[model samples]
Target: MKKIHNYFAIVFLFFALHAVGQTKDNKWTFGMDIAWVSYSEADKIAVGGKFINQTPRFSLAKYMFKNVVFVGSVSTAIGDNQTYTTFDGAARYDFGTSQNKVVPYALIGGSFINARILTPTLNFGAGSTLWFSPKYGLNVQLLYKFSEERFSSQRSHIMPSIGLVYSFGARDMNPRIWSSTR
Candidate 1:
């Protein structure tokens, strides 16, 4: 677990530094998600029962390039007797022009899940956003996650979520970073 955390920290730092060096017109987005999560193998042992669950998630994203965004997310699932948490970092690629009101995207990422045992996870998914206005939007996503623990040979999770996103900074156009030459 310690090693996994360290790896994520290093990766996050690298992306942050890279983002800072690249574009001055980058935008930031903060979002809240509601998801239905179903787990395999591990959930039985961890929760001591079989149950379907719901999770509330939060995420932050930075648009580092025209179509590339770096994202960090956290979610927690609570049941009668147990709780599970996940932390994830991912890169997303938007499929169409940003000017469009609706845009689809795909993402791949690494995740850390804290359950009965700490498990490192991998996820891949696709999602779309419907921007009602320049600063606010609705997002929907579906993700498949894979993980393994000593006690549980192989564990998988399916997560489908819907959320609202709030954007900060200029919309669609690059903001001027310096005055034009006279």
Candidate 2:
């Protein structure tokens, strides 16, 4: 497991650096997701906690490849103490290219979980982004989180979120509404 973690980390770093090299200009997105974290079976990384936590997740993403984007997010509770807070970093590989109005992707990432105590989490999931225009749209995601510590307060869980996404940069050569009439 240690070796696997190391390999995954190395691969993640390689792709992240490579993407920066390959990128030319404008491909950045900012998003806010309303996340509902469903605590799975007992010991779902929170020790006897099996419930759902609703949170607002803020994220920043950069498109590195034609099909890959790296996202970093921070989430916390609003008006609740039992909710979990997390800082996450993930890479998403979209099935559709940049031109599509809707793009679905697979995700893998790690998280620093703060429930009762701090723990590390490995997460995998799928999501999609729906673009209304080149600038704005909706984003949704579902993730399965696995806690690293077995004897701690950290437990496993499923998280799903929906939110708005805004894109900025030079994705289109000419940033204008696609209309025929002048």
Best by TM-score: 2
As a TM-score, model 1 comes out at: 0.71
Candidate 1 scores a C-alpha RMSD against the true structure in Å of: 9.8
TM-score of structure candidate 2: 0.74
Q: Global lDDT for candidate 2?
A: 0.69
Worst 10 residues of 2 by lDDT: 15-24
Residue 8's C-alpha lDDT in candidate 1? 46
Question: What digit string (tens of lDDT, one per residue) describes model 2 on residues 1-182?
Answer: 45744663565445434431112255677776678777656554445456655555778888787678899998775555475789999998876445555667899999988777788999999988766665666888998988765637677778899987766643442233343122
Model 2 segments more than 4 A misplaced: 1-25, 44-48, 149-151, 170-182
Taking all chains together, each candidate's TM-score versus the true structure is 0.71, 0.74
Task: Report the C-alpha displacement of residue 50, candidate 2, in angstroms.
Answer: 3.0
* Candidate 2: residue 145 Cα off by (Å): 0.6
